[model samples]
Target: WDGVSPDRNFTGIENYTQLFTRPELFRVFFVSFYYLAASAVQIVIALYFATVLSFDLRLRNLFKGILFFPYLINGVAIGFVFLYFFQDGGTLDSILSWFGVGGDHAWLGDPESANTSLAGVSVWRFTGLNFVLFLGAIQSIPGELYEAAQLDGASRWQQFRHIIAPSIKPVVSLSVILAISGSLAVFEIPYIMTGGATDTSTFVIQTVKLAFQFNKTGLASACAVVLLLIILLVTWIQRRIVPDDKVDLV
Candidate 1:
């Protein structure tokens, strides 16, 4: 409400200072590492799973349901789930204790590990959606092309290189666009899990903090506009770089 209120006073630090002017606000830049890493890992895993495990309809459906279920869950719930899992002597520690490591490490306690841990959660949560998308794209490629490649003595890697990758280029582009934008706009996971503390704060999380936490509604509004512009600019650049033309399945 304060963000758009015309009568609201614009004074002091909130009025004159923008995120770009404040060096401390630059912390969110580091958070982008998590987003980029998670997106890359998710896309690779999705492609691998779609290519290999998508042959059996029944099995594929079951696996897809299990993997995609996390996406259906509420973001706050996911945070709590992972919070307990990463806590000291929790699920992660219990598993690591078997290998004589991480018995005393706090996954969310350290600045270095917090963002990485959050990124891992994001990967686990969203990989299912990416998996389903890549699976559909792979399945859309005509089977006759694979049969022809097989007759020509083309190995699986060669077939993927000549057929699958090119044929699904458009889908891959779409996935990349989605991944980039979604990563930029990510909010709830970090917000709920760390409350933007421990260096896990993201762009969106900081925006909310400025508005509600510090009552810098005007600055928060500007921050949101900047984020929107960044997403649009990045997406436009991605489209310009990625070709939209369909590839020959043969």
Candidate 2:
């Protein structure tokens, strides 16, 4: 379905102004950052694994496939998986209870734990696919670069520092941009799992609520336009920092 379920009145940029009036805008921005930060860290971890795995090894392809498993599944399905994990008397709480520090906790229902739980699930489901992307990028570089670095008495860390990292900077930049934008647009996982209630409602999730639940289609459209602009602005900043020369687009 289109993100815009019902074409409503177009209010031009006024929808953008309403976003700041909400008291929870700061919290909204903070929760969104949680998603972005977690995703970025996950991508870093994935890149590390990808770099290590690029070397010849047994079942390398299988390992790559397995790593990317989470992304292939639907986002809503992934959300449900996490939903079950955090439910009262769920697997995670049970395990924690065994460790003696567990209290009766409602993961999604609690304000403090709720946003973090959603962000963590998002990272877990997504990072591997970026790993696969980075893997291909890391492997595509000519071996001569590494050879030359080694010939210059460069260490593995050094080679990665200058040769490997610079070569893959473009991929890293792209991944970061995707992470940030995706974090802002997040809806399915949060909405399905938490229903975006009790302060877990992100901007995009709130937009959905506005349209489908509240029938404020115009406001929802406004939220979407604001989100789009936010994404565009963030992307522009990233591109400015990384620049075209850093990334090997060709």
Candidate 3:
């Protein structure tokens, strides 16, 4: 049924079929890959920072607040801020100009680089949350373990590999699940920044457009359901592969 029509039509599986058959479906999922890659980088950066800051560091709390501040900002506000940032001759361009790079390039207008630019924003905003998670997990490890490892003349890397990593396996697993799910459901950033234009349309943004912009409520609902099932399947597969066994930190 069209979104505006009150007449209810029962078209069983038709919406699903249409959704799956569209050529745009492949592109939509492909766009999600950029964010997925960004999420991986975000995790690594977060973990690195978390590990470093968990130990003694100068003004660590201030640094943590600076990193996490982006996550706390309103999405709309961040979107507008980045719009200015990526616009030609904008802040990013000015900074790059210092290194002999030209400021004439359009960061968000080029289809080739649009998704990458948007994904970078995602990494900037979400890394803080992941950092906090890793930091907490690392801090919770028994201090005695580190002391024992140091007594054995274990290097920093050895202490991390043997103690920190094993103790934080659960948080790492959780971060992976969240990253995958969040990557698939990315909406607000691309929606507000690019309006899903320039090949930056994500699955969630496409669904919103189908429902509201195209008046394809039935199809949009099907897309939403499919997204949910996809997320559930991914979570199930991840759980099966990474069993939730208790990590013995001995």
Q: Which candidate number maximizes TM-score?
A: 3
* Superposed model 3: Cα runs more than 4 Å off: none
lDDT score, residue 29, model 1? 69
Estimate the TM-score for candidate 1: 0.90
> Mind giving the per-residue lDDT tens digits that candidate 3 earns over 30-95?
888999999999999999999889888899999999989989999889999998899888999999
lDDT per residue for candidate 2 within 6-113, as digits (tens), equals 554556666556666766542466668778788878888898889888877888889888788988999989888888999988988888988896686788887778
Which has the higher lDDT value, candidate number 1 or candidate number 3? 3
Residue-wise C-alpha lDDT for candidate 1, range 167-208, written one tens digit per residue? 888988999999998888889988888888888888888888
TM-score-better candidate, 1 vs 2: 1
CA lDDT of every candidate: 0.83, 0.80, 0.91
**lDDT order of candidates, top first:** 3, 1, 2
lDDT of 3: 0.91
- Badly placed stretches (over 4 Å) of model 2 are 1-14, 24-27, 98-102, 246-250
Provide backbone clash counts, one per model.
0, 0, 0
Please give the TM-score that candidate 2 achieves against the real structure.
0.87
